[model samples]
Target: MGKATGFLEYEREVPGELDPLKRINAWKEFAIPLEEEKLTIQGARCMDCGTPFCHVGRLISGMASGCPIHNLIPEWNDLVYRGSWKEALKRLHKTNNFPEFTGRVCPAPCEGACTVGKSGSPVTIKNIEKAIVDRGFQEGWITPTMPTAHTGKKVAIVGSGPAGLACADQLNKAGHDVTVYERADRIGGLLIYGIPNMKLDKGTVQRRVDLLAAEGITFITKQEIGKDITTEALRSQFDAVVLCGGATKPRDLNIEGRELNGIHQAMEFLTRSTQSLLDSELEDGKYLSVKDKDVIVIGGGDTGTDCVATAIRLECKSVIQLEIMPQLPLSRQPGNPWPEWPKVMKTDYGQQEATKLYGTDPRRYLTASKCFIGDANGNVEAIRTVEVEWSKNPQGGLIPVEIPGSEKVIPANMVLLALGFTGPEGGMLEQLGIERDERSNVKSELDHYTTNVPGVFAAGDMRRGQSLVVWAIHEGRKAAREVDCYLMGSTEL
Candidate 1:
């Protein structure tokens, strides 16, 4: 709304990324932010649409369409266009607790649902968002807003991931004494360990964690609720307990030669690599090395992309990604139209890096791994794959059917299973006796987020299964409101 003809005047522009070949040499964030003047032009591209779909957080065809946290996209864009970054940062922080994290790592569904994207490119909302928050941090506008009064009610959050962090932030704002427990050696469960440093810098994660600590929120690391401390003890100590332990039980590939040595779960590999890099810069030999080896990553998703990027950094001789499903169309198909999450092929940063180095995209669509072929030492040496065709099963569902005479073997010294997670690990749930849904996720009502137990609540990946960081923040905020109501009789979160 800053300029009526802004969309007509300005073409969509986004932040530039470092050269693929140059960026692959180190573990650092590669995206170079746009200057203020260019970002103003990008912000002007936010049209004055009567119904801005970019801010309407909803599910279209079972996929997210807009900002999951329902960020005030248009308002911030207008502010950014008019050179009111302080006001823009205020609006950005109103909903999302961690804009920096989401701005960097989130797959922007907001752009997919952008009103401007119907004909031409969408507004660079993601880059603009990053700019606002980054400026807030640089100009020293962001600070710890400690609560004026404590409610005398203590709440325990069992996770240091996005969900738990958001919940604790909101609850602390509501004057409740919030304490977070993380099982990992450091805070920021997946943020610090699971994500590669190249994507979301660990320093950024620590900065936010430190800010939360300064806000009077207590964070206890290396302490698990069900293991080191009993659930009964936690319940006795705190008035309410919110479980945000992410869905960590990774899905496995149960095939021939499943017990091979070089096959590792994506989280295990990513976690170790990050930990080693932080500890000794990979010189301690703590993480599994894939240097000078042919790497094969199974399952085509974000994690798979991360694995490919990690392998490239490790100086792997070659890399390939195996995906069971066929590749999506380059653009939206006939059945898929506007306002829905586009089902199209997206070459992520890692794939782009691999393509730059190997002269081909690492992903292999419509392929299924049959079995692992190992050497005499029992380490994975090669993998047998079969081209698959999608056919209608009797149950009226499409399933992968292996094509006859399409079997082939590919050299692979290391195989990383980037398959998605199943659900939360059962140890904590079992100890807490929380109910689980059909998907093995902690059973909690969508809006209420209340578990079967009266004082216990669940949110984020634990309740909703594996999801984006933006959704995790939304869940955390919603759950915090519900927990506040339960504790104080009436809530004002």
Candidate 2:
């Protein structure tokens, strides 16, 4: 701790955002970076707890409570407080390979599990994390730690998302020749396409990708295995293969009129929008624009929130989000307890923008969509929905029961299905003869990422279904160790 009384002296301070009305009118990042001196004061607030539960990275009450990658939070906090940014970055990278991505998107469970949070607010760990890595990149202090010699072992990573990239990074550092394959036109999969540019700039992603290329990691784009290139070729060419293919199959809304033109999957909408912005100046591309359209996004998750923000940026005529669950309480639940992920109702940046623009929160709580109503041209024009009530049934289980008089129709020219993902696409897994779990995800044990076939491994969404970026990095690191141990008769990876 910088000062023994620092926590008492400093109240918690989150980064300020751009004026709500002004930011809602644009497609740029809304949160302004904190000044370095202010950030240093925030960093000084860390008590450096004796136990330091912030880095525990464990499962509690069926949810993750701490940093999943087990980041050295206290060490880095101390480093930042001492104005040792270079040291802070080194500590930051000890576990995480992509802090820039996680810093922006992760919910920061570490803050929830913080020992300092037991009585008062937690340290500004996430802010300091982003600041450290961002400054490192800006100062040109981050560079490739290229291997001194190659072990002549070739490895093929079958995805370009966070999991695949992290696995490739660890393997490359271990002297294994690494190659990443992406079906998308770009290198960073979800980072470039699945996520919005305002949250994670594509240029920031490309900057890292460029360095990885300079360090000899070959990126093969527009090359899809089991389709463009056969799985047989992958097995025969690479000494070892790590499948990091993410869960791309979007969960559907199996209701009436689902085949209408204006209705589309959440990934389709998100990907197209990001690509369009990244290459908007170009003439030849397809992207769904929500201009002057009535948008209805079905689902209450992060994807749905993203749809709301993206649509707002496009200046939609109006927007609404539907959720099957009732609005949660603003404060934490007694059942949830401390150190467990607080299941409280906190508005994200996107929803805050929606509320500011619409004069009320756009999310319709305990609401469910029943069917799509389309216009004469077979284009979606509206959606039919119902309000629901969730209560414990006789069997001691909670279920959503619809209310009698809550049925209504909402105008919607575009309806995005942001429900969620079921599992990874099985086409390539079928070709590799990889069995799947009950959920249709690649079959693999939690700590053991090996497949039924020797020298074959799986990680990330493919192995563990859809999850957060921190989990992806964890799974990738473990999968790299498993692959490295297979390549050499050692356990050092």
Candidate 3:
């Protein structure tokens, strides 16, 4: 709304990324921040659509259409256009507890739903968002807002991931005494360990964690709920328990040679690499070193891409990503119209780096790994894969059918399974005797986070299946409101 015809005048511009070759030499984030003027122009591209779908969070065809946290996109874009960054930051924080996290990691569904994107490029919403939050910190506008009064109610969050942090932040805002329990040595669960340092700087996660601590939230690390402290004791001590443990049970490849020495879960490889980098800049050699080794990454989602990128950084000899699913089209299909999630293909950072280094994309679509072939020492040496074709079954469902005579072997000294997660670990849930859904996710009613066990609630991946960090934050905030109401018989959240 800043300029009537801004969309026509300016083209979408995102932050410049370091060259693929130059970036792979180091693990630091290579996305260069945009200048203030360019960001203003990018903000000016926001159209004057009466019904801006960018901020209207909705599920279209079972896929997200806009910002999951429902950020005030138009308002902030206008603020940025008018040179009011502090005001934009204020609006950004009104709905999102952590804009910096989403801005960096989110795929920006809002841009896909942008009105202008129907024909041309969408506004650089994600870059503008990051600019606003980063400037807020630079200008020293962000600080602790400790509550003036206490409600004497205590909340024990079972994880320190995005969901847990958002829940803890909201509960603290409502004057409730909140304590976050993390099983890891560091506070941030996935933000610190699961996501590599290059994507999300560890210092950024720690800064927000420290700010929450200053706002009167107590964080205890290395405290497992069912192990370090009994579930009954936790329930008895805290007024309410919010389970944000996340869906961390990685889907396993149960084929032969799965127990090989060089086969590992994506999280194990990523977590160890980040921890080692932070601990001794990789001098300790505690992580799985893939240098000069042939790496095979199975799965094509973000996790798989991260594995590819990490392997590239480790200077692996060769890397390949296998996805059982067919390759997505370069452009949106006819059925997927505007405002629906675009079904177009995207090349992530890892794929780009692989392409630059290998002279080709490392992704091999419609291919599934059948089994891992190991050496005499029980270490993975190669992977046997077969091409797959999708055929409609009797029930009109598409199923993968292996193509005969398509089996091939590829060198693979290291195999990383990035097949995503099934659900939350059942240890704490089993100890608490909480009910689970058909998919093994913690069962909670729609719009309400209360589990079968009273005084215990679940949210984030624990309630919903594995989802984006933005959805996790939304779940956390919504759960915090429900918990607040349950505690005080009302809520001002």
**Model 2 C-alpha lDDT per residue in residues 1-493, reported as the tens digit of each score:** 5556778899888898898779776667667889988888888888856788888888897778899899999888888888999989998988999899888888899999987787889888888889899999999999877887788999999998999999999999889999999999999988888888778878888988988888889999999999999999999999999999899899998899898989989889998888777776313446887889999999898889889999898889888999898888888777877888888897877788889888888889989888899889999999999988888999999998989988999999999999889999977999999988899999876688998877789999888888888899998998999888888878676
Q: Which residue segments of model 3 deviate by more than 4 Å? A: none
Superposed by TM-score, candidate 3 places the C-alpha of residue 368 at a distance from the truth, in angstroms, of 1.1
Better of 2 and 3 by lDDT: 3
- CA lDDT of each prediction against the hidden true structure: 0.93, 0.87, 0.94
For residues 20-65, write the lDDT of model 3, one tens digit per residue: 9999999888999999999999889998888899998788998899
**Any idea how many clashes model 2 has?**
0
What's the number of clashes in each of the models?
0, 0, 0
Top model number, lDDT: 3
> What are the runs in model 2 whose C-alpha is more than 4 Å off?
282-285
lDDT of 2: 0.87
Better of 1 and 2 by lDDT: 1
Q: What TM-score does model 2 achieve against the real structure?
A: 0.97
Whole-model lDDT, model 1: 0.93
